[model samples]
Target chain A: MKNKTNTKKGLVKAAFMSFIVVLFLTTTNCSSDGTQIVANFTEIVMQDEFNTEGAPNNALWTYDVGTGDNGWGNNELQYYTDRTENVKVENGYLLITANEEEYNGSSYTSSRLLTNGLFDQQYGRFEARIRLPYGQGMWPAFWLLGENCDEVIWPQCGEIDIMEYRGQEPTKVHGSVHGPGYSGGEAITKTYTLENDRFDTGFHVFGIEWTPDYINYYVDDKLYNQITPADVTGEWVFNQPFYIIINLAVGGSFVGSPNAETVFPQTMLIDYVRVYKN
Target chain B: MKNSKNLYLKKISVVMAILLTTVISCERELSEDAVFAEFGSNAEIYTDAPVGLTDQFFTSFDPNQGANTQGFGTDNNEAYLGSSSIRIDVPQPNDPDGGFIGGIFLDRGQGRNLTGYDALTFWAKGSTTAIIEAGFGTDFSEDKFVVGTKNVVLSTDWRKIIIPIPDESKLIQEKGMFLFSAGTQSTGGVGYTFWMDELKFEKLGTIAQPRPSIFNGEDVVQTAFLGAPVPVTGLTETFNLGSGVNQTVNVAPSYFTFKSSDTNIALVSERGVVTIVGIGSAVITASINGVPAEGSLTVNSGGNFDLAPTPTRDPGTVISIYSDHYTNVPVDFYNGFWEPFQTTESADFIANGDNILGYTNFNFVGNQFANPTVDATVKSNLHLNMYIPDNIPANLDFLISVVDFGADGVDGGTDDLRQQIFFNSSDFVADEWSTLEIPLTLANRSHIGLIIYENVNGSPLTDFYLDNIYFYE
Candidate 1:
């Protein structure tokens, strides 16, 4: 068994090296089409690979506890706590797990991790690789809110959803932008459907290239949607800096309540979160 | 061993050969200058350029005609993109009469095609924080037909300014001037100097057209009592195009064409005002730009106040008093007893096959029957059909109370008896209709009045409809 494991590791390493060589060669040469042949790379501004063990880095992440009124104003049913069982870092990944338990007068408990007051940026490429949780009432999201959230509140503070997946719709994810006029059900959103496999089956890279004039959404390097100021009814408020938030919500108005078929102890594994700038 | 080594060498050679051939073929197609350019550089890529202005005017704003008083000069020291930028010195706010007005006018002779372009992009920096008003017009004269105005803030650091053209249709093949003006009044300080560069028009993809959401007034059901003022005007018709990040467009009543399904029952004005003309039901529809929203309007006759039919009783048999039988008081009233509760007459989940009064615990008050006199000693049980909607929170506790008016004939006079009911018990099934019977003999009041329903634990209740409210043996 030891020999077999070593051989499997060797094979994986060789395949990864081959893929790198191919990408390097293709990116250097020009194609028949008139599309730009420049190398697609940017300077890394911030990154979190979750290489540490135990709790998240105190300097990078903070927690938002308790249930918001009306399920955090979304009719959600989970109590957020700063428990290790709900959020922990291990094996070079961050895990946000939602468990079915009676705690704090809620049927379930989860964690909401934020980067407010720690890290914020104006415009760049915001991305993450995540293995989503699946089952009815499971809502895991990697999104951003304006740094002025405490002062202006939601919608007015602006929100940029890099990736949001619902357990009920296992095969699709949503990218949306919310502001004062275009918030709630009226937010400017676009749906990206997985071609063959569900998002929970494996990790997928979700990214958004945000510029002053436009914001482009991508899944696995494939551009799926783009939004501009004209697409929205209100002012383009993305010019200001915004912080990040990651959470695994157990039942909200967006995902509805879980039924008998829905399983508990659903976990969302995040491989990394990286930001890049030109 | 020699053979195996040779095979491995051959495989490596084959892979290298394939890679080399692909690279050479691609390199052969590149131009001489492109071949020597630095690798992974985006500068050499030939992306699509802005329409009409192929020259880019990287050096200067050509044909720049404006008032000579405003200082304009070309500066090679500060450039946003290329080699040179335009520097303009603005006078102090109080320096010129009628406000300082200066601009750079660019006339292409023939109108440029700005159809695909949504906005003009430029980079600017000011000596101090100031406002720069820029726009385009048909001509340079005073009567020049200005298309739009863009009020942009210029900070000390360089920033990109995107000015959305108000009306693109006005730009089709017309002589136009791209202009900018800065003064003390607009900038709120002394006149300052500014620099601008990289003037171009960009198409930032197509804008998604969002469907409009129309809401008619506050509630789904609109109620107007008879003998009320004609043409009720408080009803508001609102339309939202996007989440309302933008200001919601308040469509005037004149903009909407109103129609009523039964005009004889309710006459609806163009502004969504429903005048209760008769005692009947009508559907009031308010339409704007072909989009329509409907609301049901029920006009109750003033003379007939009872909501339920009279119940028959035998001697010694307990008299059954239904909530719908109250005549002297309004169905929904706030007589300084509790928080106001909105009551709606609903046919859904009715126990007696007619209409039942449904209400939710909003503003802390539950359902209350004002000045209701019931002898709890005779009718020992207060029976009512309570239907809790699925949207209500689970494990919630509710209170049923009977307040005695006593000699004062007012609430909170002497005694009040209250009972608690847990929603999660077997007596209540969420999402389905159920019956609840509370014993009134506990109170046994001489003058039992003011039936009050409340959330015992003070938990928020969304929707709980009740019917067949009565006191019986």
Candidate 2:
């Protein structure tokens, strides 16, 4: 199956920002003319460079041990595991691998690392430098879930997907948000695509700068999307704190089933994850 | 010996430099400026007309093969891109001069440097939907890098076709612009128009994942003899295109960098020819652009080959089918692959000038010689040599059937007669040649057209060798 990467149709560049506003901010764009100052997030809150070569920093990260009922309600095929075979930190990167094999009762195994009660935040600049895997049925995502998820029903707690990629389209990634009436397929989302390049081939930065009023998406510091309270169909649940979640999920309803040609042992490598206070 | 040492040292240094990164993903290095001076780098072979090529474009196949030379030219009425397109009119089988159309387009100049191009792209359509075979890398003289894709199905509507180069870096100075062959066999010997346009080599970054293979991607272990040229065969490259088509093309050995595990036992050439030199074993492997091919060859050398005894019968009393001694008659094909049932393949080869018929994955195979039926009325016995290259199976039951097209001398006719000769397990020996001279079981031998060999009775015979077939009294 050939999935052409989504184009940059909804691109909203930071070049339109006022010169005075840009002077007080910093941008990552190497191009002099197209300077990007999406947000002023200078105060560092939490950061994981994945520089260690062993189990993740225990004090900062935790794992979702086993496959839940119906793959945690997404009907994902992989049995979540904490083993080094599925998740490990090596060579300055966090490798979350999805392997095709029988594990527990599931035919696939992968990892879901989260900072639930460990490090939760309300609004900030959350970003991760990652090099993703490629193939059908592979879903690697970096997103945030409401910290009060146990006390509230899912959409009631809110979700902000900073970066979510369908493995078949190596050049494109989607940034989205799910709320009360905008959950699952009804979520507000926008795609950011790389031109003449692919995320699976090299390292790329995926991030989101969020405030009480709006959430701006950045792929390699080029702001491509923004979602606000007005953009949601229902209640704006952004006031609550949310925890970080980075997972490599196998076959699911969003990406359909894996074909015979899908290569096994797909890995989503994360160089670092850093959150900053604006 | 000289080349292996140099290669070994180079490999060690390369492994040190790359360290532990993924080679498959990092092998794609950007092409820099070539050292060669002022070379022709024209990527386009045809546009409104021939790009860098000369005025004389189309070269038809040999006249003796019934290639209709007059049926090919540029047609302005039909073009997929420019003002005209290349149109080849495939003729009927009974065309007086030529029956099939095929040939190559040569770079009349000192050849063009196509190092930057990744694939040969073209738009094609047929008068009716037809299958066309096309590729490049064959300059007709060296024919070194010939890569051909078979069964390129084209519909009436114009569709683009892409044939990826095995390794673009190898085409430093290439003369072979394009190669194509079209026949009317698919159309039941009738004629059809095949049009191709916008022909050129393109840097289509879409062709990715070059999966090259030897022995058709199967890890093959074969017994070899000293002084025998055990040439590696079945070289191909399978690529996953941007359009989701997995295209596999037969490639030349020049595209690979061959290596032998133990050079003392055997040595492999850049041409992918493996030479069995000693009594020990060696594994031959290859790689393209640092990516290792899928298959390998483990050759177990058995000193020198022990030749089968030469036939001594008088030539007048023999109706030879195949032999080094006798002049054989015209044979149609060595293996008629009866699909859906038969699994055997003719892995035939020549070692030290001796032709050997190798039936690999053997289950059932056939040889037909029906252009003119063989009249073996005078000869009453069939003589042939058989060698079990591998271990002889315990329940080996080999059967040979000789078919005679009775009245009309036509195959599959109602009056066709057949004869069966069987060989039990006791008649075979491992690694030794056995001569089978079976007496004729058929009453009529005047119109014999086909010889079929099959393994039956729960036999596990898969690979074996054959030579010196003749019918003699």
The best candidate in terms of lDDT: 2
Lowest summed lDDT window (length 10), candidate 2 chain B: B29-38
Error of 1 at B186 (Å): 79
Interface RMSD for each candidate model? 18.9, 9.8
lDDT of 1 by residue, B1-473 (tens): 69976875796678666656666788454333232211110111011222232243221232222233536666666765555677778765445332354544443334455655645557889988887676554244432335333356889998876554433444454334356766565566577788877766555432111122223342244333333322422222221111111112222344355677777677766535556567766665555445454343344333222223244433245444444443222333422233124332222223323454445323233344444555556666666766554444655666666665565545664555544444444566654556666766454465555666656565566455565566666
Query: A160-252, model 1: which lDDT tens digit per residue?
Result: 999998887767899999998999999999999876356776889999888887888889967777788889989788999999999999888
Residue B390 error, candidate 1, Å: 46
Q: What lDDT score belongs to each candidate, Candidate 1 first?
A: 0.63, 0.83
What is candidate 2's lDDT per residue for B161-187, written digit by digit as tens? 999998888887888889888877577
Candidate 2: residue pairs that collide: B66-B98, B66-B99, B67-B98
* Interface RMSD against the true structure, candidate 1: 18.9
Fnat per predicted structure, each in turn: 0.00, 0.00
All candidates' TM-scores? 0.34, 0.82
